[model samples]
Target: MDEAPKALQRFLAPFMEQLTQKNLGNAVELMNEDERNEFDRLLGLATEPVRSFAPYTF
Candidate 1:
């Protein structure tokens, strides 16, 4: 069970790195106008700041 998570993490690490903002920005340059617009909208939703329900600040 413990090894399963570690193995999955190792497999996904490279893909996770490729999904960074810089890489995504570069990829967007290749997209058409409509694709860019849709990607930006989805990225905005994915990256929107989360709201905290706690009273104390981090």
Candidate 2:
């Protein structure tokens, strides 16, 4: 991540916020927001299960 470009980091900010917050349902909700919904949703889905028991359920 340290090597990632600034724009890439900015673009991923929202998804990172949601991931850090551990809001699974918000991932789905985030899909409806503007600003690269595809990327946000993808990352959201990918990171939602951190520190969770249902690691692979979704």
Candidate 3:
């Protein structure tokens, strides 16, 4: 259960490193600050729990 971060890092670190290594800053710069903030907010919400009946099932 606890290895999630390591597993994610293993999968994502290379892509992130490649992005930095390749300097994808232009794509990043294309997004306005407000858009970036909104995207981040949506991403955080996406990672959070939503109302569901699954937990009550037996």
Candidate 4:
């Protein structure tokens, strides 16, 4: 059971990274000040591993 998730995660890792990258790009291009702040707030709670994917900084 544990290995199953690891296997799945390994399989999906590349696609998830690509999608997260694209979404981060789009968020930067489209967000206004208020929206960006909201995004940053939400970002602060994201898991440390992927939070660096955030494309914006205060």
- Which predicted model would earn the best TM-score? 1
In candidate 2, what are the lDDT values of residues 1-58, reduced to their tens digit? Answer: 3333454455556756877565546545565456556556545655554464867787
Segments of candidate 2 deviating more than 4 angstroms? 1-4, 21-58
lDDT of each: 0.55, 0.55, 0.50, 0.50
lDDT of each residue in 3-55, candidate 1, tens digit only: 44455445334544666564544665566787666555655555667676987
| Separate clash counts for every candidate | 0, 0, 0, 0
Superior by TM-score: candidate 2 or candidate 4: 4
lDDT of 4 at 34: 74
The positional error of residue 37 in candidate 3, measured at the CA in angstroms, is 0.5
Q: Clashing pairs in model 2?
A: none
How high is the lDDT of residue 5 in model 4?
Answer: 43
The TM-score that candidate 3 achieves is: 0.34
lDDT of 4 at 33: 79
Q: Candidate 2's error at 9, in angstroms?
A: 0.2
Q: What lDDT would candidate 4 get against the real structure?
A: 0.50
Off by over 4 Å in 1: 1-22, 54-58
* Model 1 / residue 1 / CA error / Å: 29
Task: Give, for candidate 2, the lowest lDDT window spanning 10 residues.
Answer: 1-10
Q: What does candidate 4's lDDT look like per residue over 1-58, in tens digits?
A: 3244445445344435656465455545565677666555545444234334656754
* TM-score computed on alpha carbons, candidate 1: 0.46
Candidate 3 lDDT over 8-55, as tens digits, reads 445344445646454435434555777556445544554555557687
